[model samples]
Target chain A: MRRAFTEELQFISDQLVEMTRLTSTALDRATTALLTADLELAEAVISADDTIDLVRRDLDSRAVDVLARQQPVATDLRQLVMAMRMSSDLERMGDLARHVAKLTRLRYPHKVLRGPLEPMFTRMAEVAEDLVAEAGRIIANNDVEAVPQLLVTDDEMDELHREVFRTLLADDWGHGVEAAIDATLLSRYYERFGDHAVSIAQRVVYLVTGEWPEEDLHIEERMDVSRVEPLG
Target chain B: MRRAFTEELQFISDQLVEMTRLTSTALDRATTALLTADLELAEAVISADDTIDLVRRDLDSRAVDVLARQQPVATDLRQLVMAMRMSSDLERMGDLARHVAKLTRLRYPHKVLRGPLEPMFTRMAEVAEDLVAEAGRIIANNDVEAVPQLLVTDDEMDELHREVFRTLLADDWGHGVEAAIDATLLSRYYERFGDHAVSIAQRVVYLVTGEWPEEDLHIEERMDVSRVEPLG
Candidate 1:
């Protein structure tokens, strides 16, 4: 019974790792669709979400079954529980991916965004994909060292995201209003995906080290976000 | 030993309930800030995040301690694992609330989003907050019946989100590109937060019932999404 239970957990963990990898790839493809204005690839990403949803359902069910039948305790239980939560996060990340894909679909042919916005998308895509891969590796190797990698990637993503906001908010960025709006919405999607990826990485670090990395997280979440000064 | 373990598990469960409540309240404030453009409330919400983060770290440490020390098997183990997992989800949901709050600080002034757009925000807020609360109640009471509440709330959020999208994307809508972009990003944040809440409710339901909602989440997920046909 003990051996079977361990095997079941490992099986679930492996599946989680696999599903996470696929989720990352989905985001990567969706980004490509957006940048290259490929409606077909975007549609494929949208349809492919069904598969992620299925994997998510499977993972959730399997985690529950393992909990019921095998009855996990302490460390093993934590791993199983973490896997289930990460499954939901990864699945939602896939949805955001589809949202980007939807953007590609909506604005195809005419290229609604400004040419300068391309690097922002490129940087967003790079960081998003790297974080996904990082999360997958975290689960697979159960590595403690991967936390920094994820943090650094989030930094890179946030910097690119700020640039996106600054350009749009600028007076003379000159994409005009409509294209600027497209750029803004797309930036929000990218930034949030980066946040989810950070959450996953945090979970992975905890799984391995049982440490919360509290100090580090505080720094990452820190922003110039301040009270809106009274209008002069 | 078993009784002590159960008590500790119950304590963690209580924390989860409390954390969920805190998140819901914060979300309420965040949405209010979004609607009223209350920079003070938005600032307060942003600052309050530290408390949420602290609670999250505490929960993680406790769960990990219970797991590594007790090595539980079965339902007892499941509860511990789920507690940890739920805490993380709640934590991230808090972050999403924080995101909404920060968006309010961006000077979009909720007053401008009047008429149906206004009601749409109100409706989205109601559903989002209720879903968070329902998920909490489900876990707190272990009420399987409450699972359907989340489903209904999710459906409502989706519908409202679609309405927002249609208005923003319509050529006759008359708003410039900036407003449209803002609407899309804001609605997405609301929609995705609702999705997380539903997923949490589903987990709570599955925790007790050993199954996810059988009525088809895939259809539900795609239903509210704006189906703007790709520009050929």
Candidate 2:
């Protein structure tokens, strides 16, 4: 029974890594479709998102099954629950990729991105893909050391996101209101995709170290302070 | 043991209701702060989000404890897992409200939603508050019957979200690019808040009926179709 439980835990980990791979590929394809205005590729990405969702559901059920059957305590329980959370974040990342693809479909041959913004979107896509691929490696290998590099990639994505905004808000901005909106939404999708990847990496760090991530330290401090405050 | 387990389940339910209430209040205050540029209210909302996060952590730990101790199966297991999911959705809803409040802080005395956009945001806030309040009621009473009404409210929010975009993209739009970006992000906060509420309600319906929500029907259909497709 113990060996079976161990195998089940390993299976859940493998499922998460697979989900991450699919999500990474989806984002890459979605980005390509967006930049090149390839409707077929966009459709393929859109259609592929369902697979991510299905896998997430399967992973969640398996996690719950392990919980019910093994009744894992302490570290084991945390690992199982964290797997569910990571799957959720990965599924959301897939949804963000689909949103980018849908934008490509919506604009079709018109090309939603143009001018100086084109290169920014391209870079954003690259950073996002790199981040997810790293996220996959971290999950598969339990590599806590790789986590900081993921944060750096996420920072790059943020910089690109802000750059996109600056270009839209610049005085020399020539993109019409429609294009501006498209660019704004597209930038947001890539930015949020990076965020989910970082979040998954953070969960992995927590799983390995059994400590809260530093970014959450402030919130934990505030939570402590709030608890001591006199009741209103 | 059975009685204690039942009591623990009730405690988890109560925590969810409390989380929903806090989330609803946060959105209300955040919306008010956004419209009035109330720095104090915005600060309050931001600080309050930490409390939500702490409560979520506590709820999650408690849920895991129940699973490990009781080894609940079938309906009991579903309820525990669903509670965790709902708490997560509510916690995310709080974060979205915090994002709205942060926007208020970023702009300081300057209002984010000005002119015609003001009323639209006001309406969006109302719908979000209503949906969350209904979510609280559903959790507190186990009132799955109220689920459909929550969807209707979510639809209302979607309409408002679309309207905000339409105004931003309209030929007559006078809002500069910065304001447009602000409006786009703000509308998304409210829209996502509504989406979380709908998701919580769907969980409630599923908990009661043992059937998936209608909205998921299409995704399941797509998953079926994807399974038969030739591998690329």
Deviation in Å, model 2, residue A51 alpha carbon: 0.7
**lDDT of all predictions, in order shown?**
0.73, 0.82
**Highest DockQ scorer:** 2
Give each prediction's DockQ, rounded to 2 decimals: 0.29, 0.34
Model 1: residues >4 Å from true position, as ranges?
A1-17, A53-89, A106-114, A134-150, A170-182, A207-210, A214-216, A219-232, B1-10, B60-76, B106-119, B167-181, B215-232
Model 2 per-residue lDDT tens digits across residues A60-172: 99988888778788889889989999998998888888888877887787687978998998888889889888998999888999988888887787777767777887778
Candidate 2 per-residue C-alpha lDDT over B152-224 given as tens digits, one digit per residue, 9 for 90 to 100? 7876777777788778767788877778878877887788788788788888888989888878534322212
lDDT of 2 at B201: 83
TM-scores of the candidates are: 0.77, 0.93
